[model samples]
Target: MSEIKDIAKFHIFSSAYFASAVNKNQYVTDGRKEIAFIGRSNVGKSSLINSLCGRRKLAYVSREPGKTRTINYYAIQSRRTVDEVEQRQDWYLVDLPGYGFAKTSQENKDNWSAFIDEYMRKSPGLTMIGLLVDLRHPGLPIDKKAYDWLKTVAPDLLIIGTKGDKLSRNELHKNLAQLKKLFPTNHAPIAYSSLT
Candidate 1:
């Protein structure tokens, strides 16, 4: 237990808060840095964020596609410096709902589109957008649409691939190659496993 505690001491701490709407006038007032996690529905964006934070239940995870219907804001505070107290840190994690769920109504889809557009365009503290993809099928049309749109709008972004444990070595190689061909210059797709 002591070893576990020692290990956790070095990590960045994160706590999430759910928000149904993006009303700048009445949201959190923390001036911390922010990063966004976004992808198509059922692409394991929640799972990926959970894995990165080393917390199984921190971010909501659901088997049903598009379960996250709202923009969840997380206040991520780094480990306190050498002699600091329990409070005061700088950073945040922003988890936007996954887009492109097929079964949803057109109205819902339109709402999500507009919400994402507004969030990406209007947020000032947002630093980077972590664009997630499923490793089994890296470059779908919807993924391309997101990539292109973010490129034109939020250029500071990172592309990551999830659900890699399902793929064999050869398939992973091939899929990565295809992704490289599809997105040659800007970003490289990283294989990630949330289950691990």
Candidate 2:
């Protein structure tokens, strides 16, 4: 973790909006590593991405849910050490469409679900998945289903607990504990708050 932070701090990190893919054929596959972000509707997925990149409004934020209907890609450039040699690397940050309780048409929801499933199963460059969940409401049935799917298809998923700022310290800890219980042997949930 320290090494990664050092690399990020030392390198010039710049990201630009790449392409938005509505289908598998339209996805960018230029041989760059990809990290995907996914979550339920209005779970602050965009805000989390913006915060990670240290750029305000890099990912579009909306007051309404289900605004992102496609798989949005952002190209990233940075420098890192490889085998004791420093080199530049290009990667992508993929923002996948949200699931659960979206006030969209059933057809649209089904389309998004199929697209997300296909992308998860077929994207060769995919390296990691960031699964965001609101801390205040930790265990929705949709979240459980998503977790189970990822467990089978993409076991290298990182659970991110969003909206931590909305909870008190005790509540945050308790919710995090519950989250850990859901994925007991997996990596611990990352508590994230856009405010701090």
User: Per-prediction count of colliding residue pairs?
Assistant: 0, 0
RMSD of 2: 3.1
- The per-model lDDT (C-alpha) reads 0.73, 0.83
Q: Considering only N, C-alpha and C atoms within 3 Å, which residue pairs clash in candidate 2?
A: none
Candidate 1 residue runs with Cα over 4 Å from true position: 1-10, 18-29, 80-89
Assess the local accuracy of residue 93 in candidate 2 as a C-alpha lDDT between 0 and 100: 85
RMSD score of candidate 1 (Å): 5.9
Alpha carbon lDDT of residue 171, candidate 2? 99
Candidate 2 structure quality by residue, lDDT tens digits, 1-196: 2222233444547888899998889988888878888999899999987887778989999988888888999888877677888888778889998898557789988878888889988998887788899999898888988888888776367889999999999999999999998755346787999888
Q: Candidate 2: worst 10 consecutive residues by lDDT? A: 1-10
Model 1: number of backbone collisions: 0
Give the distance in Å from residue 35's predicted Cα in candidate 1 to where it truly belongs: 0.8
